[model samples]
Target: MIGSTSWVIPGTYYENALLLEGLVDFVELLVYTWDEDTKTLLFNEMDKLLQLDLSYTVHLPMDRLDNVIRAYNFFEEARFPVINYVLHPIKGWRRTLGEKVALENLKELIEPHNRMVFDVGHHFLGKKFPAHLKEAIVEIHAMGVIDGRDHLPLDRETAAFIKGFMGDLITENVLINFEVFDLEDLKNSLKVWSDTFVE
Candidate 1:
């Protein structure tokens, strides 16, 4: 399934979700923080969001595990159509979170069989893309690391690599999120993906 980061236009999570409705298969909510205000908004907009097309996947907080637990609980209780939560591998939470979360690669390549949200930009920055991790991949954060920065649009330098790698990486079960923030980058990446991979 094709996905994009919720930061695409920067109005509100629900606003973006509504805007992205039908544009992609899912929208990965960039939940870097879990607060009462966020909770209230989600609660109020839950019904409206549920009525929209497409599913959801959340990018949980990269730091604290408590926030992760809190965020997941809300979505869980709502029975939201969240594909899976993408998290930077935290310590020992796997036992608790179980299959609900996909550990993303960062400083280390996590052990396989625990589902993963493979970030192409992360590996590109480090210049390592191991085939072994593919076995664990359930979702992909597809963006390019350009000029020492990650999450840039898929430019020519990275398009060839993305096409080459994704050709083998994509599958019926895997979700590919463009993961770009700017509208222009998202448009470009979507086009590049279609041009290079889809047709």
Candidate 2:
């Protein structure tokens, strides 16, 4: 079951995601805002999302590290059946929250009901984690940044590297979000992925 994000599907038709229910496996809902006041404003949208029959894996806000716990608490209180809680290995506070400390925090914070979203793009950005951390991963935000720009689809060499790195997880059916923001790039990347992995 392949999936894509809500932002790329063309139009302000987020709720119309149900239309693609047959065509796609799931819709990744991006929750980029996690402030308490903003969450109050977003309550209706959250309610609407919770009601959807579609599966979801939320992209937690990465603007600041402070919002991390709040975002997790919000989902916990809402009781949404989120497939995984996606977060970047944020390097912003690496002086204080180095990879080891950060991963330990995540291990302690996340409840058993939810798994983690591994962002290999951030890993490329110097936010490295131990290979053992793969145990907590259920979804992968799979893209590699070559230059400064991100969300770029993986080239053949990079894709091959990722396939070898991921190894058993792919065979285990762990969800992979291509992380391409544009529709055309997403389609092209899907074709590349199918050729390499699916086909």
Candidate 3:
């Protein structure tokens, strides 16, 4: 399904979620920061969040396992039904929440159960997802890479690529997350995607 990152605008997750309720099929919750205020904001808004007509996938914190555990605990405690948990390869990382984790690129893991979340921009840096790993991709982080930068707003060419060679993941059912952080980026990406990336 088509989707956008949770922080499409500069706002709290709940605020962004509310803003994006009907705009996207799902919100890739950018659950990166771990702190009391962030916890309080999300916790207080959890009940209201359930009321929104939106689905959720979670991008767990990439750096710290403690934060990952906290994120998992938060979602589990909230009884959040996430589509998948996108994970970046981390040192000393192990399965924290069963097989729910969709291991992100930048590393190769050979375990049969190891699912994947492919980032198009990251692929620009190197290491395109191998054909053997096709079955493992559960999500696509769709965005652009200008110069040496990645995850910028998707231009028409990039959007076209998203549904073509640059994206064109084997799994047709996998989620296509805009993965952009700005509102204008999301708007442009969506329009360009719908216009050029015909299903």
Candidate 4:
């Protein structure tokens, strides 16, 4: 089951509710810089939104370790087996946060519950991304350029770079999420993957 990291559309929880009721087998709840009150409300709502007994993956709040710890505690208390924990280096305003600090904080915060979802976008943004961080994270989600320009939708150059980096850096058992918007973009991404990996 292909799980999407982003489910929330800004100012539209009803739309999110409608989408969640459909045929999605798995989901990674992308919490935005976790607030205790917000997390509690969302967790309660998720129980109602999903039709089947759903499996959960969490995109942890990267800003504060407290938020991450709260999420871990919530998952443990709820007995939800988190498939992965998606990590981002920076918190807000695209501010540069060192990867060493990020990784160190993550290790201290995360328990032995699930895998890590390392975002390539953040890695590139962070000036101090470490080689050892790759070893630490379980899965990698490659966020292609999202400039909303039709002609430059995750263009070949970026895809090739990510492909080459993934080939070299990623170890076995790491899953990759190609974050794309719309059907046309998805098609373009698939073609790139096919051309790069097959024939």
Q: What TM-score fits each model? A: 0.90, 0.67, 0.87, 0.60
Off by over 4 Å in 1: 107-113
Among all windows of ten consecutive residues in candidate 2, which has the lowest summed lDDT? 96-105
Worst 10 residues of 3 by lDDT: 106-115
lDDT by residue (1-199, candidate 2, tens digit) is 5666766655432553554355456677666767666576446566665565667766666677667656766766787666655665454433222121222123223222124556666666644545766666666666646875557865665577678777776754577777776666777777777777875
User: How high is the lDDT of residue 133 in model 3?
Assistant: 71
Pairs in clash, predicted candidate 2? none
> What shift in Å separates residue 60 of candidate 1 from its native position after superposition?
1.4
Compared to the true structure, candidate 1 yields what TM-score? 0.90
lDDT of 4 at 162: 63
Best by the lDDT measure: 1
The per-prediction tally of clashing pairs is 0, 0, 0, 0
Model 3 clash pairs are none
Encode model 1's per-residue lDDT on 110-172: one tens digit a residue: 545558777887887763656766777888888867788988887766777766766666787
The model with the greater TM-score, 3 or 4, is 3
Q: For model 3, what is the error of residue 168's alpha carbon versus the real structure, in angstroms, after optimal superposition?
A: 6.9
lDDT of 4 by residue, 68-138 (tens): 66665676677656666555533441232222112212322322212335555554444423445545555
- Model 2 spans with C-alpha error above 4 angstroms: 9-23, 35-42, 45-53, 64-66, 88-116, 127-129
Model 4 CA lDDT for position 94: 26
